[model samples]
Target: MPAYDQTRARVEDYFDRTATKTWERLTSDAPVSRIRETVRAGRDRMRDLILSRLPDDLRGARILDAGCGPGVATIALAERGATVVAADISPQLIDIAQLRLPHDLQSQVTFHTGDMLDPKLGQFDAVIAMDSLIYYTASDIGAALAALEPRVSGPIVFTVAPRTPALMAMWYAGKAFPRSDRSPVMIPHAHPKLMSAAKSAGVRRMLRPVDRITSGFYISEAMELRP
Candidate 1:
């Protein structure tokens, strides 16, 4: 397989194995939480931030929740009255996501197990790809953005693992001594490169860090791209 495909497959395997725990880390504040409460707090803040960036009301909007792991945000979008197409690369994650949808709101969400680059997924009024772009390299992100631009009528909101000097050093160290429990690979994306890609794709808009201290390392800036 090609490099990008191989990378994608590895990510699929990682998420598949950790789907349940990942969903808990993202949306729950249980007493026995595995991750830090601050981390969960940050995620909750980021989700609200993305929602705030979207239209005040999403009723009847056709939204694409790219890489919608376990469908936390997918169900949230459906509750807001959006017809959501929640797509994930891992079938295991998709199954978990589908299972989480409320019976009444099940009709509002269509789950698909596929890469975000799939062309036949159709178009949407808006696209949200929260916390999912971290797996891709800069070039892959550019290509994915190019693929998504024409399909979206409104803004594309997504997050990335930012490439700062400190984070770069940590990333290299992690690569040199990777833990078997974590994802096999993690690529920190440069803000400049992301902006360049958006410019090249003719969809450049706004970019800002989600949190000052955690932005460039733990979490990242929320980018809004428009066509």
Candidate 2:
């Protein structure tokens, strides 16, 4: 089987077991609407940062939301008049994303289940993979990015966590968090090196901070990929 399929299976199992609990934790601090509002606030900020860094405008652009869990950000972009394709490895998550959208926004958004690295998605104007690249190794991440670049006519916006001592401490503190891996944890993304690798793949880099509290986290840098 392809590595994407294998990773998909692992991620599916991880979410099947932990999604409910994670939802509960997120919603524990706020009601559903409030949670959405808070998340939207952060997402809008990240989107704005991406817009500022990117050379092209995303308004009315075709967008691919890679690993778009629950489609929160996808729906947000759709609301802003972007044609959005929300793709996730988990069908269950895609279903949730579809159900979560209103009829009008649903008309503007399309949800699909597929591996992030798959080349069959055709092409898009922009791609956004927020908080999703942590599931792969460095080589896998590069492969995924390479597979993604041709599809993007404009730029790519994604986030990666910095690998620092403070970040390592945070990961250890949250190590008990549910994981599908039966073996050692994989550290796939590193911020400084990721920018270098992306540059090698024919994408110019721009980055900024994403302001959200994530578990097992370090500094989250929002990246802009210019071709």
Candidate 3:
């Protein structure tokens, strides 16, 4: 069997321990390797794209930054005047995010370290999960969306690892030499297949495919589900 086993626990552990510092640095203005620089740039673009889906003047909006690592998107959402609940699986990462947030925006963000689909997160006008679902199976992604759909009155924006020749090769390589220190293997998904999973999960809203971004080792496709 391929050495490819990824679960929520593993992902959380990796982020909380193995990669917290790296992620913190990468998300910051600090310099990084060339490959990481591309990733940073791509993430920035994706964050901006996700934010664009929300209203320009979010004076009273309540948003969820699902699986928010270091709270970059959470910061942006709060800056737009939205009250953001930044939820992450890793408590350590959430702490880092809390520290990184500007003092003025502190009042706008509430940090939660647990499942993003927690009902106690209350509801949201919109949600964005950038690169958070890329490591999970299609079915899991679908179930997550299903859980979020009822609570969100607006759009549920997210990203996935699109199945492409290059990404497929990377997936295989990951299976061949998986390690705990590395990021979890990203499950590649075809748009049609993902949409089918979403449908199966009772998410009635159509999964609208947006732009696919590729920068060095980073590849993710953004989509939005609106009510």
Cα RMSDs, all models = 2.9, 4.8, 2.8
Clashing pairs in 3: none
Candidate 1's residue-wise lDDT over 1-227, tens digit each? 16668778888888777655756445554554444555666776777787776776789899999988878888889988999999989887788788778999998889888987677889899988887777777677776777788888888888877677766787787777646756655677777887776566555555444432263235555777764
- Measured against the true structure, the TM-scores of the candidates, in listed sequence, are 0.85, 0.73, 0.95
Candidate 1 Cα errors over 4 Å, as ranges: 33-35, 178-181, 201-217
Collision pairs in model 1: none
The digit string of per-residue lDDT tens for model 2 on 152-216 reads 77777777655666666756756776553442244535666765655565544443344433333
Query: 1 or 2, which is superior by lDDT?
Result: 1
Give per-residue CA lDDT, model 3, range 89-179, as digits (tens): 9998998899989999999999999988889999899999999888888888888899899999999999999999999998898888748
Query: lDDT score, residue 225, model 3?
Result: 96
Candidate 3: 10-residue stretch with minimal lDDT:
1-10
Off by over 4 Å in 3: 1-6
